[model samples]
Target: MGEERECCHHRTKERSEKEYKDMINRLSRIEGQVRGIKGMVEKNAYCPDILIQVAAVTAALNSFNRVLLANHIKTCVTEDIREGREETVDELLATLQKLMK
Candidate 1:
Protein backbone atom coordinates (compact mmCIF):
# COMPACT_ATOMS: atom_id res chain seq x y z
CA MET A 1 0.00 0.00 0.00
CA GLY A 2 2.80 2.44 0.80
CA GLU A 3 4.32 1.75 -2.59
CA GLU A 4 1.19 3.08 -4.31
CA ARG A 5 1.92 6.65 -3.31
CA GLU A 6 4.90 8.94 -3.88
CA CYS A 7 7.02 10.13 -0.93
CA CYS A 8 5.78 13.74 -0.72
CA HIS A 9 2.00 13.34 -0.98
CA HIS A 10 -0.28 15.16 1.46
CA ARG A 11 -2.60 12.17 1.59
CA THR A 12 0.25 10.00 2.83
CA LYS A 13 1.17 12.39 5.60
CA GLU A 14 -2.43 13.02 6.58
CA ARG A 15 -3.16 9.33 6.75
CA SER A 16 0.04 8.54 8.61
CA GLU A 17 -0.60 11.14 11.28
CA LYS A 18 -4.34 11.70 11.60
CA GLU A 19 -6.01 8.37 10.91
CA TYR A 20 -3.25 6.18 12.28
CA LYS A 21 -2.95 8.16 15.51
CA ASP A 22 -6.70 8.06 16.02
CA MET A 23 -6.74 4.32 15.50
CA ILE A 24 -3.82 3.73 17.84
CA ASN A 25 -5.38 5.84 20.56
CA ARG A 26 -8.69 4.05 20.26
CA LEU A 27 -7.01 0.66 20.27
CA SER A 28 -5.10 1.59 23.42
CA ARG A 29 -8.33 2.54 25.15
CA ILE A 30 -9.93 -0.68 23.98
CA GLU A 31 -6.99 -2.62 25.37
CA GLY A 32 -7.54 -1.06 28.75
CA GLN A 33 -11.24 -1.84 28.49
CA VAL A 34 -10.45 -5.45 27.72
CA ARG A 35 -8.19 -5.65 30.72
CA GLY A 36 -10.98 -4.29 32.88
CA ILE A 37 -13.32 -6.83 31.39
CA LYS A 38 -10.92 -9.61 32.26
CA GLY A 39 -10.69 -8.32 35.81
CA MET A 40 -14.46 -8.23 35.99
CA VAL A 41 -14.63 -11.82 34.88
CA GLU A 42 -11.99 -12.84 37.38
CA LYS A 43 -13.90 -11.13 40.15
CA ASN A 44 -17.08 -12.96 39.19
CA ALA A 45 -18.87 -9.78 38.23
CA TYR A 46 -22.31 -9.91 36.61
CA CYS A 47 -22.41 -11.39 33.14
CA PRO A 48 -24.41 -8.51 31.72
CA ASP A 49 -21.85 -5.99 32.97
CA ILE A 50 -19.02 -7.87 31.31
CA LEU A 51 -21.08 -8.13 28.16
CA ILE A 52 -21.61 -4.39 28.19
CA GLN A 53 -17.88 -3.77 28.31
CA VAL A 54 -17.39 -6.17 25.44
CA ALA A 55 -19.97 -4.25 23.46
CA ALA A 56 -18.18 -1.03 24.28
CA VAL A 57 -14.95 -2.44 22.95
CA THR A 58 -16.69 -3.56 19.78
CA ALA A 59 -18.20 -0.13 19.29
CA ALA A 60 -14.85 1.55 19.86
CA LEU A 61 -13.24 -0.66 17.22
CA ASN A 62 -16.06 0.06 14.81
CA SER A 63 -15.73 3.79 15.37
CA PHE A 64 -12.01 3.58 14.77
CA ASN A 65 -12.64 1.73 11.52
CA ARG A 66 -15.21 4.30 10.39
CA VAL A 67 -12.74 7.13 10.84
CA LEU A 68 -10.04 5.21 9.01
CA LEU A 69 -12.39 4.38 6.18
CA ALA A 70 -13.51 7.96 5.80
CA ASN A 71 -9.92 9.14 5.64
CA HIS A 72 -9.10 6.41 3.14
CA ILE A 73 -11.95 7.55 0.91
CA LYS A 74 -11.01 11.22 1.12
CA THR A 75 -7.34 10.60 0.47
CA CYS A 76 -6.58 7.31 -1.24
CA VAL A 77 -9.75 7.03 -3.29
CA THR A 78 -9.62 10.66 -4.26
CA GLU A 79 -6.03 10.27 -5.39
CA ASP A 80 -6.99 7.19 -7.37
CA ILE A 81 -9.73 9.16 -9.08
CA ARG A 82 -7.39 12.04 -9.85
CA GLU A 83 -4.86 9.60 -11.26
CA GLY A 84 -7.55 7.99 -13.45
CA ARG A 85 -7.24 4.60 -11.80
CA GLU A 86 -10.92 3.68 -11.69
CA GLU A 87 -10.04 0.17 -10.62
CA THR A 88 -8.94 1.46 -7.21
CA VAL A 89 -12.43 2.81 -6.65
CA ASP A 90 -13.84 -0.69 -6.89
CA GLU A 91 -11.11 -2.01 -4.63
CA LEU A 92 -11.81 0.63 -2.02
CA LEU A 93 -15.55 0.01 -2.19
CA ALA A 94 -15.06 -3.70 -1.76
CA THR A 95 -12.76 -3.11 1.22
CA LEU A 96 -15.30 -0.80 2.86
CA GLN A 97 -18.03 -3.39 2.44
CA LYS A 98 -15.85 -6.05 4.00
CA LEU A 99 -15.00 -3.78 6.91
CA MET A 100 -18.66 -3.01 7.49
CA LYS A 101 -19.39 -6.69 7.89
Candidate 2:
Protein backbone atom coordinates (compact mmCIF):
# COMPACT_ATOMS: atom_id res chain seq x y z
CA MET A 1 0.00 0.00 0.00
CA GLY A 2 1.17 3.51 -0.85
CA GLU A 3 0.73 6.13 1.83
CA GLU A 4 1.76 9.74 2.05
CA ARG A 5 3.06 11.32 5.21
CA GLU A 6 4.51 14.65 6.16
CA CYS A 7 8.31 14.57 6.29
CA CYS A 8 10.01 16.32 9.16
CA HIS A 9 12.90 17.39 6.98
CA HIS A 10 10.77 18.36 4.00
CA ARG A 11 9.70 21.94 3.38
CA THR A 12 8.21 23.96 0.57
CA LYS A 13 8.38 27.52 -0.64
CA GLU A 14 5.76 29.57 -2.45
CA ARG A 15 7.51 31.37 -5.26
CA SER A 16 6.36 34.33 -7.26
CA GLU A 17 5.29 33.78 -10.86
CA LYS A 18 8.44 35.42 -12.20
CA GLU A 19 10.66 33.39 -9.92
CA TYR A 20 8.93 30.17 -10.88
CA LYS A 21 9.24 30.93 -14.57
CA ASP A 22 12.86 31.89 -14.26
CA MET A 23 13.75 28.65 -12.49
CA ILE A 24 11.86 26.54 -14.99
CA ASN A 25 13.43 28.35 -17.92
CA ARG A 26 16.90 27.83 -16.52
CA LEU A 27 16.28 24.14 -15.90
CA SER A 28 14.89 23.73 -19.39
CA ARG A 29 17.99 25.25 -20.90
CA ILE A 30 20.19 22.97 -18.82
CA GLU A 31 18.13 19.99 -19.92
CA GLY A 32 18.62 20.99 -23.54
CA GLN A 33 22.35 21.26 -23.01
CA VAL A 34 22.46 17.76 -21.51
CA ARG A 35 20.49 16.41 -24.46
CA GLY A 36 22.95 18.05 -26.83
CA ILE A 37 25.79 16.26 -25.03
CA LYS A 38 23.97 13.00 -25.41
CA GLY A 39 23.55 13.64 -29.11
CA MET A 40 27.23 14.40 -29.41
CA VAL A 41 28.03 11.08 -27.83
CA GLU A 42 25.61 9.24 -30.09
CA LYS A 43 26.99 10.91 -33.21
CA ASN A 44 30.63 10.19 -32.26
CA ALA A 45 31.59 13.81 -31.91
CA TYR A 46 35.13 14.80 -31.02
CA CYS A 47 36.09 14.23 -27.41
CA PRO A 48 37.23 17.82 -26.94
CA ASP A 49 33.98 19.16 -28.33
CA ILE A 50 31.89 17.02 -26.03
CA LEU A 51 34.05 17.90 -23.05
CA ILE A 52 33.61 21.59 -23.80
CA GLN A 53 29.85 21.18 -23.93
CA VAL A 54 29.93 19.33 -20.63
CA ALA A 55 31.95 22.18 -19.13
CA ALA A 56 29.34 24.64 -20.38
CA VAL A 57 26.61 22.62 -18.71
CA THR A 58 28.57 22.64 -15.47
CA ALA A 59 28.92 26.41 -15.64
CA ALA A 60 25.21 26.78 -16.27
CA LEU A 61 24.40 24.63 -13.25
CA ASN A 62 26.76 26.66 -11.07
CA SER A 63 25.15 29.88 -12.28
CA PHE A 64 21.76 28.50 -11.36
CA ASN A 65 23.01 27.59 -7.90
CA ARG A 66 24.38 31.09 -7.39
CA VAL A 67 21.06 32.66 -8.27
CA LEU A 68 19.13 30.28 -6.02
CA LEU A 69 21.53 30.79 -3.10
CA ALA A 70 21.28 34.56 -3.37
CA ASN A 71 17.50 34.36 -3.38
CA HIS A 72 17.54 32.04 -0.36
CA ILE A 73 19.76 34.42 1.58
CA LYS A 74 17.69 37.45 0.66
CA THR A 75 14.34 35.85 1.47
CA CYS A 76 14.49 32.81 3.74
CA VAL A 77 17.64 33.66 5.65
CA THR A 78 16.68 37.29 6.09
CA GLU A 79 13.17 36.49 7.27
CA ASP A 80 14.36 33.81 9.64
CA ILE A 81 16.90 36.11 11.20
CA ARG A 82 14.30 38.83 11.55
CA GLU A 83 12.09 36.38 13.41
CA GLY A 84 14.99 35.56 15.78
CA ARG A 85 15.46 32.07 14.39
CA GLU A 86 19.18 31.80 15.03
CA GLU A 87 19.26 28.20 13.82
CA THR A 88 18.75 29.50 10.29
CA VAL A 89 22.18 31.08 10.44
CA ASP A 90 23.69 27.75 11.38
CA GLU A 91 21.80 26.09 8.59
CA LEU A 92 23.04 28.72 6.15
CA LEU A 93 26.62 28.14 7.28
CA ALA A 94 26.28 24.42 6.80
CA THR A 95 24.87 24.97 3.33
CA LEU A 96 27.72 27.27 2.45
CA GLN A 97 30.23 24.70 3.61
CA LYS A 98 28.62 22.05 1.49
CA LEU A 99 28.54 24.32 -1.53
CA MET A 100 32.18 25.22 -1.05
CA LYS A 101 33.14 21.58 -1.01
Candidate 3:
Protein backbone atom coordinates (compact mmCIF):
# COMPACT_ATOMS: atom_id res chain seq x y z
CA MET A 1 0.00 0.00 0.00
CA GLY A 2 2.86 2.35 -0.74
CA GLU A 3 2.03 5.68 -2.42
CA GLU A 4 3.64 5.11 -5.76
CA ARG A 5 2.09 7.01 -8.65
CA GLU A 6 0.26 4.31 -10.56
CA CYS A 7 1.36 4.70 -14.16
CA CYS A 8 1.87 2.18 -16.89
CA HIS A 9 5.18 3.72 -17.89
CA HIS A 10 6.62 4.21 -14.46
CA ARG A 11 8.40 1.76 -12.21
CA THR A 12 8.15 1.52 -8.46
CA LYS A 13 11.07 2.09 -6.15
CA GLU A 14 11.53 -0.19 -3.21
CA ARG A 15 12.15 2.08 -0.28
CA SER A 16 14.64 1.14 2.36
CA GLU A 17 13.16 -0.26 5.56
CA LYS A 18 14.11 2.89 7.43
CA GLU A 19 12.41 5.12 4.88
CA TYR A 20 9.24 3.05 4.95
CA LYS A 21 9.16 3.12 8.73
CA ASP A 22 9.65 6.86 8.84
CA MET A 23 6.76 7.49 6.44
CA ILE A 24 4.51 5.10 8.34
CA ASN A 25 5.38 6.82 11.60
CA ARG A 26 4.59 10.23 10.16
CA LEU A 27 1.24 9.00 8.82
CA SER A 28 0.40 7.44 12.17
CA ARG A 29 1.07 10.71 13.96
CA ILE A 30 -1.10 12.56 11.46
CA GLU A 31 -3.89 10.01 11.94
CA GLY A 32 -3.72 10.51 15.68
CA GLN A 33 -3.88 14.26 15.26
CA VAL A 34 -7.00 13.88 13.13
CA ARG A 35 -8.61 11.71 15.80
CA GLY A 36 -7.77 14.35 18.40
CA ILE A 37 -9.44 17.00 16.27
CA LYS A 38 -12.52 14.82 15.95
CA GLY A 39 -12.63 14.43 19.73
CA MET A 40 -12.30 18.17 20.19
CA VAL A 41 -15.26 18.74 17.89
CA GLU A 42 -17.27 16.09 19.66
CA LYS A 43 -16.59 17.80 23.00
CA ASN A 44 -17.37 21.29 21.68
CA ALA A 45 -13.87 22.64 22.12
CA TYR A 46 -13.11 26.33 21.42
CA CYS A 47 -12.83 27.27 17.77
CA PRO A 48 -9.32 28.71 18.09
CA ASP A 49 -8.10 25.58 19.86
CA ILE A 50 -9.52 23.32 17.19
CA LEU A 51 -8.10 25.49 14.45
CA ILE A 52 -4.68 25.22 16.04
CA GLN A 53 -4.90 21.46 15.97
CA VAL A 54 -6.02 21.57 12.35
CA ALA A 55 -3.03 23.71 11.50
CA ALA A 56 -0.76 21.17 13.14
CA VAL A 57 -2.25 18.45 11.01
CA THR A 58 -1.67 20.52 7.88
CA ALA A 59 1.92 21.15 8.88
CA ALA A 60 2.46 17.45 9.46
CA LEU A 61 1.03 16.67 6.03
CA ASN A 62 3.36 19.18 4.42
CA SER A 63 6.32 17.59 6.14
CA PHE A 64 5.25 14.20 4.84
CA ASN A 65 5.01 15.64 1.33
CA ARG A 66 8.48 17.11 1.57
CA VAL A 67 10.00 13.84 2.67
CA LEU A 68 8.21 11.88 -0.01
CA LEU A 69 9.06 14.41 -2.72
CA ALA A 70 12.70 14.45 -1.75
CA ASN A 71 12.88 10.70 -1.94
CA HIS A 72 11.04 10.65 -5.26
CA ILE A 73 13.37 13.21 -6.77
CA LYS A 74 16.46 11.49 -5.44
CA THR A 75 15.54 8.00 -6.61
CA CYS A 76 12.72 7.84 -9.14
CA VAL A 77 13.35 11.10 -10.92
CA THR A 78 17.07 10.59 -11.11
CA GLU A 79 16.71 7.10 -12.45
CA ASP A 80 14.21 8.13 -15.03
CA ILE A 81 16.35 11.02 -16.20
CA ARG A 82 19.34 8.72 -16.51
CA GLU A 83 17.29 6.40 -18.64
CA GLY A 84 16.38 9.28 -21.00
CA ARG A 85 12.75 9.34 -19.92
CA GLU A 86 12.09 13.05 -20.34
CA GLU A 87 8.38 12.60 -19.65
CA THR A 88 9.11 11.92 -16.03
CA VAL A 89 10.39 15.44 -15.62
CA ASP A 90 7.15 16.82 -16.95
CA GLU A 91 5.21 14.55 -14.61
CA LEU A 92 7.31 15.73 -11.72
CA LEU A 93 6.74 19.36 -12.62
CA ALA A 94 3.00 18.81 -12.86
CA THR A 95 3.02 17.12 -9.47
CA LEU A 96 4.93 20.02 -7.96
CA GLN A 97 2.44 22.48 -9.41
CA LYS A 98 -0.42 20.58 -7.83
CA LEU A 99 1.39 20.55 -4.53
CA MET A 100 1.90 24.30 -4.72
CA LYS A 101 -1.80 24.80 -5.20
Off-target runs (Cα >4 Å) in candidate 1 are 1-19
lDDT at 79 for candidate 3?
Answer: 72
* Predicted candidate 2 versus true structure: per-residue lDDT over 1-101, tens digit per residue: 47432211225666778988999999999999999999999999999999999999999999999999898888777877777787888988999999899
User: Relative to the true structure, how large is the alpha-carbon lDDT of every model?
Assistant: 0.76, 0.85, 0.87
Task: Give the range where candidate 2 is weakest over 10 consecutive residues by summed lDDT.
Answer: 3-12
Q: After superposition, how far is residue 83 of candidate 3 from its true place, in Å?
A: 0.7
lDDT of 1 by residue, 1-101 (tens): 45645222343444456546767888899899999999999999999999999999999888877876777777777877887878877887798788867
Top candidate by TM-score: 3
Candidate number that wins on lDDT, 1 or 3: 3
Q: State each candidate's clash count.
A: 0, 0, 0
TM-scores, all models, native as reference: 0.76, 0.88, 0.89
Per-residue alpha-carbon lDDT of model 3 for 1-101, expressed as tens digits?
A: 77754232335657678987999999999999999999999999999999999999999999999999988888788877877888999999999999999
Candidate 1 has an lDDT of 0.76
Model 2 clashing residue pairs (backbone): none
Quote the lDDT for 32 in model 2. 100
Better of 2 and 3 by lDDT: 3
Model 1 vs. true fold: TM: 0.76
